[model samples]
Target: MITLSGNTIYLRALEPEDLDFIYTIENNESVWEVSNTQTPYSRFLIRQYLKNAHQDIYEAKQLRLAICQQETGETIGLIDIFDFDPKNNRAGVGLVIGSQSHRNKGIGSEALALVIQYSFQQLQLHQLYANIGSDNEISLQLFTKFGFQKIGIKKDWNRVNNVYKDELLYQLIQ
Candidate 1:
């Protein structure tokens, strides 16, 4: 699915124009916990990544989309379907809004709904999963709202600021 639309937002394929946006997000330390990123990335790497964004999910085993506002067409975030296993009909889903000001406004909800539809319907996937930090109430609620159940929790899974935290595995089966 090249583009998946919701009422207020849409998911579009990553484009060369998104190089700066992707670089900013990749270097944003605030989102490192959710993205499992330990260090910042340079623009050269991001540009090279964008160059390979055209690979299909089956070929690349992942799909990253830019989340754009419907009204203004300004990209606000990104969503990903990674570890795609066509033989198993399952994949991992994750998303992040670039700014705090753009969060908690139902933008993520809309973006996720569209991806879920695309994953399950167009992609013909049987299930999707997300790894969320235990302390992340917002993400927990959002996934649960879409029927993703918490299957397990890994204790001391992630270290943030030298403190270990639990990571919850949530799954949505079709």
Candidate 2:
């Protein structure tokens, strides 16, 4: 398992033991709304997703991490480095704070910073991109705060709550 540490937060690989925490967050409607994931996630589905991720990890195709509080050691969120392009040294990033109590605590930013450093330094990735829903102001602001530029927008990219919504694409070139 990969581990990253920061002043206020830390990240480690999501293990089978963390599945319950993941389920709690994945099933939350508020988390799914901004994350473009379906709510009321079942254990079977999460297990399937984890199985796929485990396979990818074995193949060295992806890096999926669980974000947690350094002091409490509580699993609060997840981060992924996906869509890896080795030739271009780039990858796509996604993050979700599953625990409502952890929201707006600077933990997410800390985790993002640590992961970006890992992606660029350890993984030798030259760039990273994040795609967020247009209406997700907090996520947009968070990424922007990390120097991610608004590259473009995809119209009607996601169908949420029975309505089409735009997706804002942001990129960070290291």
Candidate 3:
């Protein structure tokens, strides 16, 4: 995977050494709520996730990258292109800005732009889509700022905090 940099953010392939950071971030309830990942994250789980990412990359099923601060090298988030259909030239995108301190700092937007550039320029993907929970207004707005159009909403598609929530599907075509 290509390491992309801009402003104060940089993205690189998710490494095994990043498990600790991933564990800390994903374990936070605030972070997990927006992500809809209810299971408590641990170092062991992160290792497994990284292993799966490695396998997926080799098999061309998906690509995962870690978003870090350029100067400090602290892992702040993760971005991924999943459900890739090479024949159709399309993929699903996922992102999580793990650090609450980093929220609203524009880092997520920059990292997202970098990932889109990589998807279109390097992976040659023609379309990228995001499935976001209706309650995740921040992410919805974030993707919207990047030109992703709201295609439709999936009724009661997700269960969060013991309640069913709709998922809004958005897409950006290159």
Candidate 4:
């Protein structure tokens, strides 16, 4: 398992014990916009997914890591490397802090730094990208703080509450 630790938080591979946390976050309608969740997930389905959570990222083509507090070992958020393309040495990054209380803290920043370091150094990736909704200023700021430049925009990319929203593509090239 890969564990990347920081001063306040650490990123670790998913475990069977995280089923409830994953299920709750996946089904949270308030966050569905960013997560692209269409419907609630059943516990059975989540259990099945957790059973295979240990698969290698090379085989799974994506990796979802839990962001936990270093002191309490409580999961506060998740960071994912999706749409992995090893041949191109690039992947899309997705992150969520799970609740409003967790937002605006330094947790996401620390986790992002750890993930970027792991992606570039351990995974040997050349670049990493993030797709953030135009209205999500906090996330845009977070990625930009790490030198992820705004590469392009997908006009009216995501639909939320029956309205279309633009999605910005930010990239960090190593």
What TM-score, computed on C-alpha atoms, does each candidate reach?
0.97, 0.88, 0.89, 0.97
Clashes by residue pair, model 3:
none
Measured by TM-score, how close is model 1 to the native structure?
A: 0.97
For TM-score, the strongest prediction is: 1
Q: How does candidate 3 score on lDDT? A: 0.84
Give one digit per residue, the lDDT tens place, for model 1 in 1-174.
344988888889999999989988999998999999999999999999989999989999999999999899999999999999999999999999999999999998998898898999999999999999999999999999999999999999999999999999999999
Candidate ranking (lDDT, best to worst) = 1, 4, 3, 2
- Model 4 agreement with the true structure over 1-174: per-residue lDDT tens digits: 344899988998899899989998999998898888889999999999888888888988899999998899999999999988999999999899988887888999999999999999999999999999999998999999999999999999999999999999999999
**23: Cα error in model 4, Å:** 0.9
The lDDT values for all models are 0.94, 0.83, 0.84, 0.92
User: Mind giving the per-residue lDDT tens digits that candidate 2 earns over 1-174?
Assistant: 243898877888767888798888777787776666774888988887777666653266678898877789888888888888888889999888876677898987998998888888888889999999998898998999999999999999988879999998999999
User: What lDDT score is found at residue 92 in candidate 2?
Assistant: 90
Q: Which stretches of candidate 1 lie over 4 Å from their true place?
A: 1-3
Better of 2 and 4 by lDDT: 4
- Model 3, residue 117: displacement in angstroms? 0.7
What order do candidates take by TM-score, descending?
Answer: 1, 4, 3, 2
- lDDT, candidate 3, 69-104, per-residue tens: 989998888888888898899999988887678889
Give the TM-score (vs. native) of candidate 2. Answer: 0.88
Task: Assess the local accuracy of residue 173 in candidate 3 as a C-alpha lDDT between 0 and 100.
Answer: 98
